[model samples]
Structures are given as C-alpha cells and as structure tokens.
Target: MHEWALVEGVIATAARFAEENGITEVTEVVVVVGELQQVEHEVLEFAFENLKTPLFKNARFVLESQPARFKCRNCGNEWGFTSEGMTEDVSEAIHFVPEMAHVYIKCSECGSPDFEVAEGRGVWLATIKGVKGDE
Candidate 1:
C-alpha cells in the first residue's frame, strides 16, 4: 500500500534529520493525515513497526486525522464533510470510491455537485520529536 511508502519516506527523512541534529533517540513521528487520503491507521502502525528498527527502534508513530472539507463551485459555499452520522452502507460505498463524494455530497448552499476540495487531500509530516545522545 501507499502507506508503506509514505511511512518509509517519513522515517527516512526524519532519521536523516535526527542524525544530522545529533538526535540519538527518535521518540515520535507525528503525521498529519487528511481524510481524503483514506490512510489506514493500523496499517500505518504496522508499517512503522516493520520499518523503524534500523534508526528508530524506540520511535512511535502518531496520526492526526483531519476532516474532509469541500467548497461549492457554483455558490462558493464551504462545509465539512461529516461522516460520523453516515450509514454503514453509504460509508462503505464512499469508502470504495471516494471520488463519488462529489456525486453523492452536494453543496448545501445551492445543491450542486460541482465543487472543490478545500482540505483533506494529502499526508504531511507535522513534527519529529527526539532526544539527544547525551540526554
């Protein structure tokens, strides 16, 4: 899965930076993930467990999931795509094809499917916390 690649990149980048900065122990790797990415948290954790032994044996991965947001192309209305109240069937359907969001989720202002994603699209390495070799 792409999460593996993402985790690997995050670890490699952070590890390089940590070594350059004299960090001996990477304590945590915080990833900011948008819902549109559909990154599985457990899978990310698994990847981290498998991929971190080299430079970050004691490191822990943390994911901060952000909500999806959209802006109506017609009416310029912006709103969060709340999935907490969605039915299981609908959730599964959308989970299968997230692009169907524009088809199923309409603009609240003008009831239009034409819209743009205001947020929730990619993953970012928010921070890498570590301790120095002396500390």
Candidate 2:
C-alpha cells in the first residue's frame, strides 16, 4: 500500500538527515500523524523495525496522533473526528477503506459533507533526538 512507500520515504529522509548530522546513535524519534492521513502507526513502526539494525535497534519510535478535524464550509463550524468518524474498523482501520464505501467528513453543525480539514490531516516527523560528540 501507499503506507509502505510513505514510511520508506520518511525513514530514508530521516536516515539521510541523521547521516548528514553524523548522528550515530539516535535515542528517540517522534512522528505525528493526522487522523485524515489514515496512516497506521503500528505499520509505520513495523517498517521501522525492518530497517532497524544493531545500531538503531535501541532507537525509540514514538507516534503522536491527532484527531481528525474539519471546518464546515457552510456554517464555518469546526469539529473533531470521533469514533463516529470511521464507518468500519478494518484489520488496519487507519489504512483500509471499504471497497464501495466512501469516507465522508460531514460538518457536525450543518450536517453537510462540505468541509475542509481543520486538523489531523498530515504526517510529520516532529523530531529526532541524538547526541554529537568527539568522533
């Protein structure tokens, strides 16, 4: 799925940055995922595990998820995603979509589907903590 590509890309980018900074021992990595992005944190971590070697095995991957939010196009009302936001819980609900079902983000105030993402809509590697010393 696209998640694999996405995760790979993230890791590659981070690895490059780490290398450039001469980060030999990464202690922690934090990633943020917006609800609308629909990325499975576990899957992302699993991918990270595959890439982890003796050096990075001790690295910690922390996932921070933000609730999906939307602003009503008509009433200017904003709302957060709730359990009601998902129509079904797939094996990996964060990454799976029903074949015939379309995901809708309806405005809580106007009961309209016209809305813009107000929050929980993107993926970002927030930080990478490492130490640099005598080389």
Candidate 3:
C-alpha cells in the first residue's frame, strides 16, 4: 500500500532531521494525517512497526488524523464531506484515486465545483520529541 511509502518518507525525514541536529534519544514522532489524503492509520502504523531501525527503536509513532475541509471559490463557503455522502461509484473512484475527490466534493452553500482545500490535504510532521545529547 502507499502507506508504506508514506511511512518511509516520514522516517527518512525524521532521521535526516535528527542527524542534522545531533539528536540521540528520539522519544516520539508525531505525524498529522489529512483525511483527504486517505491515509489508513493501520497501514501506516504497520509500516512504521516493520521499518523502524535502532535510531528510532525507542520512539513512539503517533498519528493524528484530521478531517478534510474545502472552501468554495464562488461563495467563499467552506464544507466537509464523508464517504457516506458519495454514491457507490464515486466512493470507489475516491478510494482507488483520492484525486477524484474533487469530482464529487461541492460547496454546500453555493453548490460550486470550484473550491480550494483549507485543511487536511496531506501528511505533515507535527512534532519530534528527542534529546540532543547533553542539556
């Protein structure tokens, strides 16, 4: 699954950051996942569990899932949608290719197809708690 790739990227980035900063004891890695990105938490955790190395052996991987939000281009209206709102076909499309979300998401107030994502669009590294050698 793509979650494997996602976890790999996260580990790579965190490792690079730790090395650059001389961090020796990484206690936690907090990741914020966007709903629109459709990141499966179980898969992401499984990937981390399988791939983490000694540098992060003691680090806890924390995933914070967030809702997808959109703003209308026409009326400045913002809204969010759940998969239940979609037709079976639309849901299937989004499940396989999340990019298709735009085809189904519409502004609730203005019914505009044109809109921008206000939040919950992608994966982000939120916090890394670690020790940088001595105080």
- Give the winner by TM-score: 3
Q: What's the TM for model 1?
A: 0.73
lDDT to native, each model: 0.81, 0.67, 0.82
- Write candidate 3's Cα lDDT for 12-35 as tens digits: 999999999999878899999778
- 17-113, model 2: which lDDT tens digit per residue? 7888988777788878776656677878888888665446578988888887678788999777655545565423444441111144456777876
Cα TM-score per model: 0.73, 0.73, 0.84
Better of 1 and 3 by lDDT: 3
- Cα lDDT, model 1, residue 122: 60
Which has the higher lDDT value, candidate number 1 or candidate number 2?
Answer: 1
The superposed Cα distance between candidate 3 and the true structure at residue 44, in angstroms, equals 1.2
- Backbone clash total for model 1 is 0
